[model samples]
Target: MNPSEMSFYQPDHDAFRVSVREFVQREISPFYLEWEEQHLVDRTAFAAAGAAGVLGTRVEEAYGGGGTDDYRFRFIVAEELASAGAASYSAGLAVQEDIVIPYVMELGSEEQKRRWLPGLTSGNQLGAIAMTEPGAGSDLQGTRTTAVRDGDEWLISGQKTFITNGIQSDTIVVLARTNPDAGSRGFSLFVVEAGDSGFSRGRKLDKIGLVAQDTAELFFEKVRVGRDRLLGEEGNGLRYLMERLPLERLSIAVAALCSAEAAYGWARDYVFERQAFSQDVGDFQTVRFTLAEIETELEVTRAYVEAATLKLNRGSLTAVDAAKAKWWASELQQRVINRSLQLFGGYGYMLEYPIARAYRDARIQTIYGGTTEIMKEIIGRDIAARAKRR
Candidate 1:
């Protein structure tokens, strides 16, 4: 689809999008199945992306990035990656752009930025954020990992699970409970490097989908961290996560929408080519009408996501708005996938088809980024507050 038909992206944005799409087609798409079999993409892919200036487009120019501060560039990255049926690539990059870079840019001291931003921007150092523990998934109050005060250093002991880019990460921004007695104010963020004496990595996890992406368990056993490692302020991890999570959710929404778009396009092409009953499936009224309805809904959904993207660029996006986008786009993506698969009949169920793998991977979009139920709770509270104001 021409991006011009979509109102969210401008002409310049479309130009950038086309370049990124070409990059994915030429460098990544053909080799993805092999990478999936190995359970990891070749590290060379990251370097190639960095060299192309696609990996960290927003980081300042002095630090080896393109220095375009626009978030739209990041959105283009998400959209193109999704179009290629490479959600793992989209997600792994989100860790670098959406999840990790923000902490260093907004909260890190000058010395910290000077030391890490250049390498991070150049894809020399991969990063991950450690938040969800074995005991706590969404409830920050239940976090049990603790960082204790010891003169100028803090000793941290905790375990974090389901961390993206965890296996190969060179730096991790860890969220630990610094004050056990305080409820929301008790947590703090710390930056821990790979070689921290007591820090160790757990097994790279086997997951249901996104197999090429590294998802692993992490353990910090009496890890000693210097004062400079603290990210924002002491007892402020909750606040930092709150500030960053909307972007993370938005990234998930972008990926889900793009994946659905790709699936729709693939299935549409397949129906026209496959003949049955001496006619193309596309010739059948039922198949034609099914695609029509799906296409309309997808276009409408794209408009909503684009509007949200604009709000995000303007720094006007709210948590409730992001919740609405994340939940609705993901739910719509699943619906589109299901309907498209039905049109494909038996071929859709085959492992060889890309749609089958997309269906499997799309399942986690709702579950991981705060489930649909959680999103409703957030939206419900917003509704209640507005009612009271009235």
Candidate 2:
């Protein structure tokens, strides 16, 4: 809502936002609370997004996708969904559209693309990425899942935890160790279908926030992944994960900011209407100043996020830039949401209010999509490497 023209958004972006807003209002807003109770957004919700042409902005049109690779449309979807207090479903959609779809587009072979792209774009079949294991969260090198090559298939056996869309996903892109002692080079990416033998989903995790998102543990017991199922070259999985991480980090940053801003709006409206002592809470000088500070912070973060978004569109976004945005925005969101919830007083603690839900949902932004500590390490290491080169 800041008036600055960041160049990342234009007339087309505005139109797309309107369309997505209408869709969210009609399809998601009415039933999000029920979905949260179930601990999973109904699969029909994604089908609605697909029907509206909002789920496949980056996919090719030949495969039932939006045909344009513009990321702003995708950004609009994330922004609108979060603004509607549909953060849980938004996180799930982010995994599908931003994380999994992009990997397949970049790393999948022609056959892989043809087999997966249509259902993915259409939302008839969901997609999920399996990365974090019980032993490996931020450290990709610690991956212990092994894939041994057999006659025509690679027998994979390991467990992946905290898998997004775990239960509903039809194809899961898994990273497994192909060579036991190759360090980071030992890893390989495999597209494992849900129907494969020994591929089973564990219990859906009972998360503190984002409850409507299907987060679960996945088990692969000698799962058969054919040679053609390999994504790009073997021993190059870590490199692929590294390359695609910037966008995923950026997605988290965007969600954090928009979610925070929405919470602020809810708090502002409540404080103005609710009576405290003798007058509206907004009449207090301290309350007014707090609103001013949060508004300013949101504007400043928006400028940086817009700059990064444009850079991504240009194919010039760097990992360090993304790390900076991810850590700062997520940390800022926590601050802003905590303050906003305080403004609501007793109402904020009640689960019936949007601010309360936003308070809970905002907690996980810093932990997932790479933790704040991990992001700081990435930025710090990049700076040290640059200094050495200079």
Candidate 3:
């Protein structure tokens, strides 16, 4: 079912979806090929998205954002982007809206908000969260990046890899170790600006899919920032990360479900239209059964994701719940896209086909945010703890 048909969405949400759909058609669909070739989307597209009122729907009106705090609007954006086969663009925007904005809004001091929120909400600037290192992917505790206090300033030095929007972001929320002896409490978050001395962007890493999204290595060689640049309290970065991860995982789940739905729609329509042995390809019982399975899986998954989105809006979504949604929906997306591509036979293997690109794009859903294995670990640990308490 389309997001409009979902009972969780109000009429206002439907209206926002219309604007988002139009934005995708006009700004993204036309230039996506050029972006894919260049390995990055033009910065103007983000500005257009900001103008269209789709970039920062949850930020406060005082900050030049939509100011609703409603998660459904963000889901609507994801749905429309998936429908338009704009996965790369969606991933980049998710980092801004889902990860960076929420971190700032929840943890930043008033001055930090005033300084960063306006440009971010207006799409005049981009933001990224630097968490993963060369050695750390899911393990936040393994982070080697360090920040040392220097009188009124802090000197941050580290390397961050696989950072979305790394190249174009005007601001980055960097996670660093502040007290080596403090364990989990040792980590802290620092706001790094683009022109800061000792800060440099490495190569835009090549990936198999989502090519238009710029992922790069970020280096900090004693990048200095005043106490004012520190986000929240010192030694609270890991706690902050854990607190905010539910929204990030939920955003990934939303994109995965929407992409699966779009792929299913494409396959269903193609199977009915394409001719085979004296009949439509969909007339075959095997194809009919495959479509049935795909539809059923999508419908069931949508219900869970819808519930999770509501929980997020109500401020009750848990890490365990988000983990379940993330792993299930992302794995489902890969399966649905793979099966849907099979429906197209030879045509599915070509890049000209959206399903082919989607197939490539879907592969990363299971790996990023948190991997399928990591999600299971989170859920499994919760289950074990609950059993012990019982």
Please report, in order, the local distance difference test score of every candidate based on alpha carbons.
0.86, 0.90, 0.94
Estimate TM-scores for all models: 0.97, 0.97, 0.99
**What residue runs in model 1 are displaced by over 4 Å at the alpha carbon?**
none
Clashing pairs in 2: none
> Lowest lDDT 10-mer window, candidate 2?
1-10
**lDDT, candidate 3, 34-67, per-residue tens:** 8988989999989899999999999999889998
The true-versus-predicted C-alpha distance at residue 264 of model 3, in Å, is 0.6
- CA lDDT for candidate 2: 0.90
**Root-mean-square deviation of Cα positions for candidate 1 versus the true structure, in angstroms:** 1.3
**Alpha-carbon RMSD, candidate 3:** 0.7
TM-score of 3: 0.99
Candidate 2, after superposition: displacement of residue 326 in Å? 0.5
What is the C-alpha lDDT profile of model 2 across 1-390, one tens digit per residue?
642244667888888877998999999999999998888899999888899988978898877888886777877887788778998899988998999889888888889998998888888889999999999999888988999999978999999999989989998999999999888899999999989999999999998888889999999999987898999999999999999999999999989988888888888888999988999999899999999999999989988997898899899999999999999999999999999999999989998888888889889889988999999999999889989998
Candidate 2, residue 29: how far the Cα is off, in Å: 1.0
Model 1 residue 170 lDDT?
A: 91
Cα deviation at 389, candidate 2, in Å, is 3.8
Candidate 2 local lDDT, residue 4: 20
Better of 2 and 3 by lDDT: 3
Per-residue lDDT of 157 in model 3? 98
Which sections of candidate 2 miss by over 4 Å? Answer: 2-7
